[model samples]
Target: METWKEPQTIILWIIIVALFVIILLTSIIFLVRTIFKKIIKAKEKEAAIQLDYQKNLLETTIKTQEIERHRIAADIHDGLIGKLTALKMQQEITSKDQKTIDALHESITVARRISHDLSPPLVEFTKLPELIKELLDPWEQHLLITTIFDIRAEINDTEEFKVQITRLIQEIITNTIKHAEATQMYLHLKQTENYMALYISDNGKGYDVAKNSKGLGTKNIETRVQFLKGVYKVKSKIGKGTSNMFLFKN
Candidate 1:
C-alpha cells in the first residue's frame, strides 16, 4: 500500500509539471499574437495619416492655383490692356503728319507684339510644339538652346489636350531659361502604353527643391500636370542639374 501511495504521488507530480509547461506555452503564444496585432494596428494608423496628409495637400494646392490664375488673368486684362489703351490715347492726341503717324503705327505694332507674346493666341489656336518653339525663339541665340521636338503633328487636331500641353511647355521652358541657368536643354515628347511622356532636362546648377519654396513656378507645373490628368516628377540635386518629367494618360 505504501509503494502504491508513492507511485501515485510521483504520477500526480508528473501531471502537475506537464500542466505548467502547457500553461507557459499558451501564455507565450497569446503574448506574441497580441504584439503582432499591436504592430499591425500601428501600421494601419500610419497609412491612414499619410493618406489624410496627401488629401489635404492636394486641396490646398488646388486653391492656391485658382488664386494664381485669377491674378494672371487680371494682369492681362486690367494691367497690360490699360497700358496699351493709354498709349493709343497718346497717339491719338499727337500730330497727324505722315512721319508722326508712321512712328505711332510702328509703336502700336511693337505694343501689340508685346501683348500677344504675354497672352498669345497660341493658347487657343496653335499646337503645343509650335507654341513652344515660338516662345523659345528669342532665347535660342542667347542661351545656345537646342530643341528636340518630338511633338506629334496631329496633336493639335484635338482641342482638349492641346491648350493645356502648350501652357505646360511654355512654363517649363520659361523657367528653365530664367532660373536653371542651363546652357543646353532637351525636350522629348513620346507616347507609350497609352500614355504620353514629356521629358525636359537641363544641365545647370541644381536646386534643393525640398527646402526651396514651392512657389508659382512649381505650382504652375503641378497645376498644369494635374489639369492634364498627368503624373509629374521633378528630380534635382545640388551640382547635378534638374529634370522635369511629365506622364499623361488618355
Candidate 2:
C-alpha cells in the first residue's frame, strides 16, 4: 500500500510540472508577439509621417515653381515682347528691307510663343477642351494628334488646378516627341459629375515602364498627378506602344 501511494504522488508531481512549463511558454510567446506587433505599428507610423513630409515639401516646391513661371511670363509679355513689338513697328516704318522686317516679325512671334508656353492666358475663362486643343495645335505640325472630348459636365475647377492638368498633358506630349519617336498620338478626355478621366497614347517606340519610370519626364508626370490628388497608371511594352490613364475624383 505504501509503494502504490508513492508512485501516485510521483505521477501527480510530473503532471503539475508539465502544466507549469506549457503555461510559461504560452505567456512568453504571447508577450513576444505583442512586442513585435507594437514595433511594426511604430514603424508604420514613422513611415507615414515621413511620406506626409515629403509630399508637403514637394507641393511647396511646385507652388514656388508656378509662381516663378508666372512672374517670368509676366515679364516676357509685359517687357520683352512689348519692346520687340515696338521695334518691329519701327522697322516697318523706317525701313523697307523685307528681310529685316521678316526677321523682326519672326522674333516677335517666337517671343510670344515662349511667353504663351511659360504661362497660358485666360485659363480660368477657357474651356478645358479648347485649352487642350490650343496646346496640341503646334504639336500637330510634328505628329498626327487625334482628340476625343466627351465632356458631360464643366470642370469649374480653379485656375491652378487647370494649369497643373494642362502642364501634365504637356509633359506627356513632350516625352512622346522626345523619346517615343512615334508619329501618331491620341488623347481622350472624359468628364462627368463624379470624376474626370484622361487617356493618352502614342504609337511611338515604347519602353519598359519598370526601367524608365525613374526618368525625369515620368517623375514630372507623377508629381503633377499627385498634386492634383489623382491616380494614374502607365502601360508600355517595347516595340508596341505606351499608354497612360489618369483619373481625378470630382
Local distance difference test scores for all models: 0.71, 0.90
Instruction: Give the alpha carbon lDDT tens digit for every residue of 1-250 in model 2.
Output: 6764798888997899999999999999999999999999999999999999989998998899898988999998899989988887888888867898888888878787777777989998988888889888879989999999998987687888888988998999899998999999999999999999999999989998888889898899999899889999999999888999999999
Question: What C-alpha lDDT, on a 0 to 100 scale, does residue 135 get in candidate 1?
Answer: 67
Worst 10 residues of 1 by lDDT: 151-160
Candidate 1 stretches with Cα past 4 Å from truth are 1-16, 92-141, 149-175, 178-180, 203-243, 248-250
Residue-wise C-alpha lDDT for candidate 1, range 1-250, written one tens digit per residue: 6764798888998899999999999999999999999999999999999977876776576557545654665575567656656665676677545665566566655555454454555465776667667766755765666667664434433444664566677687778778888887777777544667788888888899897648787887786677566899989988888888998875
State the TM-score for model 1: 0.58
TM-score of structure candidate 2: 0.88
| Candidate 2 Cα RMSD after full superposition onto the native fold (Å) | 2.4
